[model samples]
Target: MNIDQAISARHSTREYTTQAVDEEVIVRLIGAATLAPSAMNLQPWRFTVIRDQALLDRISREAKACLLETLAPGAQSERFHALLDDEHFQIFYHAPVLILISAEAPGQSVVEDCALAAQNLMLSACAEGLGTCWIGFAQRYLNTPQGKQALNLPQTWVPVAPIIVGHPKTEPAPVAHQAPQIRWIG
Candidate 1:
């Protein structure tokens, strides 16, 4: 698929089938991620792919508990609270693979670079007829020391994006998006 088609086809896939993604396809997606533009050639991104179901389940539970503990009681917390109330909610949606895009440095640009890499990876997955979703809910817990130990992440690597990839169970409908408000300046 072309870039345009990939971009249009890529969406946040929350549900996936039990089918496993090929290792070669996973490698290709990561290769695409590495090609993303970085600031000053500082390719600070590192990836950790998780395929173990037990680990994924533990991470999901810990992440939800961590989020609940940290959230303040207010309007913003209500949505999260409601989500946590669901007993069967899996943060990664039981995807066959979970890829964490991390950065070695702590800075705004480093974070941006990792995010760019994640976008590239997602698009590549779409082109390969796979589904991908960026799970922000996993971020907070994944950054913690215990979480880092669980994933065997390096001390310097900071988790920036949690993405799940697999074969989609169903195709999502087109999302209605508003046109960007642009101001021309010459």
Candidate 2:
């Protein structure tokens, strides 16, 4: 698919099939991600790919607990709390691949750079007929000591995006979009 097609088709896919993604495809996606521009040529992004079912489940459970413990009592947090209470809920959705994107530097710009890379990866995956979803719930746990040890990430690295990649069980219908609110000053 073309870039425009890929961009248009790309959406967060939660459910996935048991089929595994090819290593070559994963490599290509990462390659595309690395091509994203960074601030002052500082490519601070690092990626950790997780395919182990047990590890993913552990992360899901720990992340749920962490969110519950840390999030302040508010209506905004209720949805996540409910999801966590569901025993069938898996944060990674049991996808075949879980890619954690992290930044080596502690800066807002570094996080944005890593996010750009993630966008590239997702779009690339879409073009390759793969599904990807950025799992925000995994971020908190992934930054913890145990999470770092689980992924073998360094202390310097901070998790930016936790994305699950796999073959979608079904083609999802397009979601409606709102028009951009533009204010041009010329």
Candidate 3:
């Protein structure tokens, strides 16, 4: 698919099939991600690919608990608390693959740079007829000591985006987007 098609088709996919994504496809997508521009040419992104179901489940449970324990009591947090509290809430949605775009070193715009790469990866996955969803819930646990150890990531490397990849059971219908409000100053 073309870039425009990919962008139009790309949507956050939560439900996925048991089918596994091929390693070559994963690598190709990551390659696409790496082509993204970075601030000051730092290219401060590292990658960690995880395919272990048991580990993903464990991380999901731990992260949910962490979010709950530290979540401030408020109406805004209620929805999150309810969702995380659900026993069936698997953070990665049991996708066949989880790819983390992390910081290679601490610096400004590192997260932003990694985020750009993630967008590229997701869009590329869409073009390839694969599915990807960035799992924000997994980030908290992934930054923890146990989470770091589980991934064999170094102490300094920071996990930026936890994206799951798999075959989608069904393509999601397009959702309406609010039109952008433009203010031009010439």
Candidate 4:
């Protein structure tokens, strides 16, 4: 698919099939991620791909627990708890691969660069006939020391986002929103 088609078709997929994504496909996704534009071409992003079921489960549990401990008692936290039930946690949409995006410390634009990389990965997944979900919620815990140790991430790398990838069980229709109101000065 072309870039426009991928942009139009890409959507967050919360459900996925049981099939596994091949290593080559993941490599292609990473390759696409690398093509994203970066500030000063710093390219400060790194990825950790998790495929082992036991490890995935451990990360999920730790993530949820960490959120529960830290998040303020608010509607958002309540909703998170409701959505991330035991069943949802068990399968994680049954996606075979979880890609953790991280950024190197030092640059002020590191977060933005990481976000760009994530968008590229998601768009590339769509082009490859795969589904992806950008999981920012996972960062709440994945940034912690326990999460760092769980993923064996380096101390200098800060976790930014996690993208879940697999064959989608259901495709979400595009969501509509009002166009942005901008003030343009020529």
- In the predicted model 2, the residue pairs found to clash are none
Count: clashes, candidate 4: 0
As a TM-score, model 1 comes out at 0.96
Candidate 1: deviation at residue 186, Å? 3.1
Off by over 4 Å in 4: 84-91
Q: What is candidate 4's CA lDDT for residue 181?
A: 100
Candidate 2 structure lDDT: 0.90
Q: Model 1: per-residue lDDT, tens digit, 98-139?
A: 999999868769889999999999999999999999998999
Q: What is the lDDT of residue 43 in candidate 2?
A: 90
The TM-score of candidate 3 is 0.97
| Structure candidate 1, residue pairs in collision | none
Best by lDDT: 3
TM-score of each: 0.96, 0.96, 0.97, 0.92
Local accuracy of candidate 2 as per-residue lDDT tens digits, 109-172? 9888999999999999999998999999888888898888878889889999898999999997
- Give the alpha-carbon lDDT of every model: 0.91, 0.90, 0.92, 0.85
> Stretches of candidate 2 above 4 Å error?
none
Q: State the displacement of the C-alpha of residue 130, model 1, in Å, after optimal TM-score superposition.
A: 0.7
Question: Candidate 4 lDDT, tens digit per residue, 112-174?
Answer: 998999999999999988999877668877788888899899878888868999999877877
